[model samples]
Target: MLKLTDKQALEFGIQPVHHQMDNGELRFRLTRDTGSSYILTLSAEQSGWQSSHVHLRKREFYIVEQGWIVLALRQSEQLTFRRLGPNDSFMLPPGLPHNVYLSEGSVLHTVKYGSADADWEAAPELDEKLRHETFDGKTFFTR
Candidate 1:
């Protein structure tokens, strides 16, 4: 008989997972259904950041797990802002920009229902927030 751990399964292509960075925040894609869609887990501990931009080929959804964050997204970076909380979530209805700012010790569990490339970029003006940020694309170790 043979068995596989989650990490092992991930490496063997039996499972698909990806982790990313939000300046200093910790975020990941865990337990994905590659045949159709997938889900993501985004964890972060940050402050003083209030904006970002994203280019997604498919719509994306997010569900918060813990802590607090402010989501301000737009089609032209000049639109109105929307805020979210620990028990709150939202969807980016495809081809729009997404900006998520993390409060201290904030963690989010996101569920994406499509297979598309997402181009995520934090505002260049957020250099102040990047200081002491704890994201390394795999795990987070606070400063």
Candidate 2:
């Protein structure tokens, strides 16, 4: 799991609230004062792949703080797979269908414009292909 150094934590000037998810992942909610929020998440190797979903109105930004992760995004009839590692960042606009596969020791830092629980919508149709497809460690495009 990636963590903030003492110097880094002091620089941020914010306290984080910790939570343990049901999937055994560790999450830290860093800020929630305004309409936006920041979150830090550490994924367990055994956490497996996440289901496909989309946000109807919310937007999200993510940075890979440690280890590796695969983001599978579907746009229209085409699908794109992006393999991300430390320092890699991406943004998801509203109405984009996506899923994530976190590798062992993966850590992600996220910024959200709104509450995920309220805007999240499931996209079960993408699950079958997204979960079973092979990622080649590069950006891949498929129909």
The top-ranked prediction according to TM-score is 2
CA lDDT, every prediction?
0.54, 0.77
lDDT of 2 by residue, 108-138 (tens): 9988786535677899988877766754445
Candidate 1: the clashing residue pairs are: none
**What count of clashes does model 2 give?**
0
Per-residue CA lDDT of model 1 for 1-143, tens digit only, reads 88878878767444655655545554444544442334544444445353455545555676766766555555453444455666898877756665665656666666554553434554543333443343323343322
Q: In model 1, where is the ten-residue run with the lowest total lDDT?
A: 134-143
TM-score to true structure, per model: 0.59, 0.72
Name the lDDT value of residue 80 in candidate 1: 40
Q: What lDDT is obtained when candidate 2 is compared to the true structure?
A: 0.77
Enumerate clash totals for all models, in the order shown. Answer: 0, 0
